[model samples]
Target: MSKQPPLDKFERDVLDESVPIQQLLRLVIVLGGRAFSEPLRLWARNELQGYPGPGIPLPTYRMITAPLQMDSHSRFSQGRNETISALALPDVAHDLVSEQLPVTFSVGKLQNLISHQDPHTPLKLGLPGSAELARLMTSERSGQGVVVERIYWSVHASALHDILEQVRNRLLEFVAELRATMEPGESEPTVGQVHQAAQTINITVGDHSPVHVIAPHRHSATVSFPTRPHHRWWPRR
Candidate 1:
């Protein structure tokens, strides 16, 4: 009988008795992708620092914090021929939210497992860039000072899911084709080669709670935050 692969640290941590999977699930957002860019490439390199064997590295864990900025613009018009000019506020408060605990996976092994199927097999995969946009508008005419407000919000949950799923499916298809084209006794392609060929990005938003704010208009405000976390993850060419 074939021996089962040993569980990695991440799997052990999740299955550990001390750390309840329920609470961890609440704190963690699981994201997987075959298309890897600088952010995930660097993460994989760092994670594989001491890993053994030729398989792809395990997932890496880190706490990422960054300043979020929001900007708004408003305009009012009476008719198609009329133009209205509104006051441009100099200083406006911006809402910022801090997210936590995002888990990322390389998923090369998973792709390899799926690639064992026939080359012509088809998988029902999601679209590439599914997204949702939300807008809200409020107006008060009877108030002493008229207040007209509009809010625009967007989220990429569907898009992220689509990219991840499609990337996996594509990887499977590529691997199947490669296997089919090889000689009868030729060696198969490595997981790293398959991963290197297919690169993608997948993100999961965990918590959207407002953490802190940096007001450039106010000198007293504390504006201490690291430069974008993804910048540090650029892969060394």
Candidate 2:
């Protein structure tokens, strides 16, 4: 068997849970820049600094789906704000409910949120077009005096932790590939070697190719809730 290269130490570091993910990401950015791999560098940069804006493709792992909730008041539940499903809005307003919420936060931001959050309380993110949805839903039942206060997604902390774990796993995979590509006694990988290894990995390259994920078959729990009557027509926003 050939002696492991010094760069192999990175594999051990990647496997260490105590090592901050941001630290590994910074190292990746440095390695990517040294290797002249734009894709690798860009990916690491985005993870550290966050994606520029909307319309940019995000990694499949960064997309998470959470239950939508809304705080509102109706004649039936007068005076008190009732928390109900944002999905309970009229069928016309259903288009506003995003099934998959893209997590564009930087790795460091996510880490900070997870660290300070209480395990029992979920982090709430304001849903886009929430105001519009509230207006539409309120107008649809104007006679009923329904007032929509807030619309947001209740995201579990574990989900954010999962994203960090996935990032670590990807780094581990890349380092392993780098190790395999290194020649005996070589301390570091060449630019060609780095590029070749990156091409084999799905997310390392900037290509927006679809990542096929096989979801485990798990039985979903049935949730019963009171919902408003469906409207045949959608009110124009």
Candidate 3:
């Protein structure tokens, strides 16, 4: 029988606590310059065990349940504009900071890329090839650059503050290591735009009754539950 990969401290804690799925949040990490989709996907899969969605849940909770998706304009061609998203529950976000999983998992994965000097390494996860394209995008010598456009998290109001703190602290370490790996004399890459916004839904009454949509801005239409029933339906991200 194949041996299972060892779980990190955070992973152990997650399993120990049996963290419930409170809120599902979508985190989009946009790369400004060309990011080879295949290699990036491979890297995520091999190192993080984050594969294309719909994915089975893992202990890490930092699963990339979606594939590397590019903007509509760059769908057919290799373009600098691209996006990769992953899903994390509130409990998972908490562990990333509390258990220092970002340093061991996130930074460790990045360290693998910097240590391998060859850009043409075979495409293998946890191996050199899978990270080749990702390495190039971040390398100053390659001329092709990669910058984060933004990191947006669609979350509920209650879990916003806690999740934001975890993400911010973890991202600081992640970005720092990425910059440290750049070629000599290369300008350090800037941290990508980070936006945390509450998700909103428009609820319309089926009885032709006036509805009050409360939010900074409103768009999209959804069926509103009747107030008489006091039905509680929380939207998922």
Candidate 4:
């Protein structure tokens, strides 16, 4: 029988619920660098650093649906924050107020947010173009002096937690598949082999479209992971 290899150890580490997401992510980064796959490295980097800008499309998993809220006050009242419907806003603001808002915070940042926030409180995200939308709303009112102060998307902490879970699950699926590709007794995989494994699972690894819509993996395994403990691992050169 073939002896356990480095890939096997890495696989075990991935399956260990105790391993922090950041550490696993760093390992992925190392693997990507070793494989010389820019796409692989880019995926890991984006997760660690958050998506850079609009130019880089976010993975479908990062998109979330949440309640749109508006904080406003009239000349009479102090301020009121309440859930606002998209229809209430001008047509110009409709697109920004939709259910799906891309979350671009890094893994560490997300964990920090969850730790600091109360479980019941929803995380508020200020939407772009909110000021302009507020102006439009005030103009529509045209008399009562109801000025909108903020327009934001309110997401539950659990929702953010779910994003981390999805990422972890996807990583588990990836490493398991990659390990399976190694020949018995092979301690390491070739660059071609690594690239092939990524392609088989439809992970973004190279020059393809930046956005990836995750699908059910053909090699999906039924496993439950423990709640991850907070730990951090910074990548090394």
Give candidate 3's whole-model lDDT: 0.26
Q: What are the clashing pairs of model 1?
A: 35-199, 35-200, 36-199, 36-200
Every model: Cα RMSD to truth: 20.3, 13.0, 25.0, 10.0
lDDT for each residue of candidate 3 in 35-62, tens digit (9 for 90 to 100): 2123222322323322222232222323
lDDT of 1 by residue, 154-187 (tens): 2223322332354334324433443454346544
- Model 3: how far is 62 from its true place, Å? 8.3
Query: Number of clashes in every candidate structure?
Result: 4, 0, 4, 1
TM-score of 4: 0.77
Give the RMSD in angstroms, all C-alphas superposed, for model 4.
10.0
Which candidate, 1 or 2, has the higher TM-score? 2
Q: Could you tell me how far off, in angstroms, the CA of residue 132 lies in candidate 3 after the best superposition? A: 51
Best candidate, lDDT: 4
Which 10-residue window in model 4 sums to the lowest lDDT? 222-231
Q: Write the per-residue lDDT of candidate 2 for residues 1-237, one digit (tens) a residue.
A: 886544655777788899888888887777766665567777878888887665567888888888777777876884323345646766765664555777889999999999999978888887655676678777876888878777778888999999899888888777777678766766656666676666545672224584332212221221111011222344455
Which structure among the candidates has the greatest TM-score?
Answer: 4
Runs in model 4 with CA error above 4 Å?
1-5, 75-79, 204-237
> What lDDT score belongs to each candidate, Candidate 1 first?
0.27, 0.69, 0.26, 0.70
**lDDT over C-alpha atoms for residue 217 of model 3:** 20
Q: List TM-score per model, in order.
A: 0.24, 0.76, 0.20, 0.77
lDDT value for candidate 4? 0.70
Name the weakest run of 10 consecutive residues (lDDT summed) in model 1.
127-136
TM-score-wise, the better of 1 and 4 is: 4
lDDT of model 2 at residue 106? 93
